[model samples]
Target: MSLPDLPTGWQVWNEEPDGRVILTFRPDVFTEDEYPAECLPTIYVTNGSRKRRPGAGQYQTEEWHVELFLEPEIEVLTETFDTRDAALEGAVDVAGRFADGDVDPRAHYQIPREDYFAALDRLTGDE
Candidate 1:
């Protein structure tokens, strides 16, 4: 299936032949000098298992998953789907919600970065 149109500040970072897709948000602004690069928001669409085991998700599974991550270790949301297309659609929806300021990334952070959060609010029109 073709990739869907992404919301402002979001882009298709990568797509695998096996249907695993990675979408990134505002890579340009998430620099070391501005917002920490590690905090960049991302959406992963995959058909692999959600198990934490290292190789558990190496093989594709029956269910598709769309996961939103505020950081490498912080997951904001997860949605399951019956098909890859559905998962991609779900990812787009999640991206839209984030771009519209509907998803608050600040809540997931252990140490709040007030300056960064304020900048994000302006970027997402949440201010």
Candidate 2:
């Protein structure tokens, strides 16, 4: 299957044989010196099962979801889609939103971490 087009500043970080893809943004700037690998902005499109909460369930089910991550945190996520194409489209849209600075980590976190905000400042050049 063909993969969706990535945003201007993003690139394919990984592509598994099973069709899962990890896309990273501005790798040229967001290096280890500027940002930690785990905290780098990313979009993950996968058909993997939702990670179960601790002691929350027994049976595991698979679903297609587009996850928008700002470094070590999930800033946004979409409801599960039945098709990979739909998930990919959702992921692409989220990635675009991220590129345009449309996402706010604070909106998701009650109290955003200092380190995370600092990292976000560096990533987006926002003072």
Candidate 3:
């Protein structure tokens, strides 16, 4: 499937043949020097279940899911769709909301990274 136009700072990080898409925000700024590499924001579009159980999504399901994450383990939002097209649309919407600074990533962090938060605010125009 073709990817729709993404908002600024967002890019298609990877696309698998199995129809999974990974979108990342501002990779250039998420370097170890500027920002924590592990804290990079990302969106995942997949046909897997949203269940947390191990191996639950090992097999593809009929439903598609769009998951937004501030970090690898920090899921910010999740939306389910009946089709890949709908899931892609949902992912785009989530990316737009995040790029526009509507979604707060700082709240997900346990240890405050004040500098990183400030930089993120500036990048997302939340400053």
Candidate 4:
């Protein structure tokens, strides 16, 4: 998909045991490019028996359109990116944050990537 812009006030969620992440936002908030092919369009569940992705359209969405990723990651758990800017911003946010150490899955916000100092300069400066 084509890369898009990032969204503002967006947040990433990470699992505690491992270090997987889940980004929850509206699709309209991000761009196409922000999402890469490496990112899978699937969710996970702690219970209810883990079902491997049987291709597309096999999974169901939650009441809040929340994607479940029992084994979370950058792609499997991103918010539905609808806009271009938000997408780009999300890429920056993900690479910046997860590139460093893992975060608490239950945490409201995440820590920035260690080497993201350069991107942070632009990420924080963006409008």
**For this target, which candidate reaches the highest TM-score against the unseen true structure?**
1
lDDT of 1: 0.91
Clashes of 1: 0
Q: Which lDDT tens digits does candidate 4 get at residues 1-127?
A: 3333324533443332322234433223233454332322223212121245554333433311224331235323444444334444455445434323222233322554333333323333431
Point out where model 3 deviates above 4 Å.
none
Evaluate model 3: give its TM-score.
Answer: 0.91
RMSD, one per candidate, in order: 1.3, 3.7, 1.5, 13.1
Worst 10 residues of 1 by lDDT: 115-124
The 0-to-1 C-alpha lDDT of every candidate, in the order given, reads 0.91, 0.69, 0.89, 0.34
User: On lDDT, who's better, 2 or 3?
Assistant: 3
Q: Candidate 2: where is the Cα deviation over 4 Å? A: 53-62, 73-75, 110-127
Residue by residue across 62-94, what tens digits does model 2's lDDT show?
667677776555656555677777777777788
lDDT of 2 at 71: 55
lDDT per residue (tens digit) for residues 1-127 in model 1: 8878999999989999758999999999899988899988899999988899899887789999999998899898999999999899899999999999999887788988888788878888999
In terms of lDDT, which candidate is stronger, 1 or 4? 1
Q: After superposition, how far is residue 93 of candidate 4 from its true place, in Å?
A: 0.2
Instruction: For residue 30, give model 4's deviation from the true position in Å.
Output: 29
C-alpha TM-score for every candidate: 0.92, 0.72, 0.91, 0.25
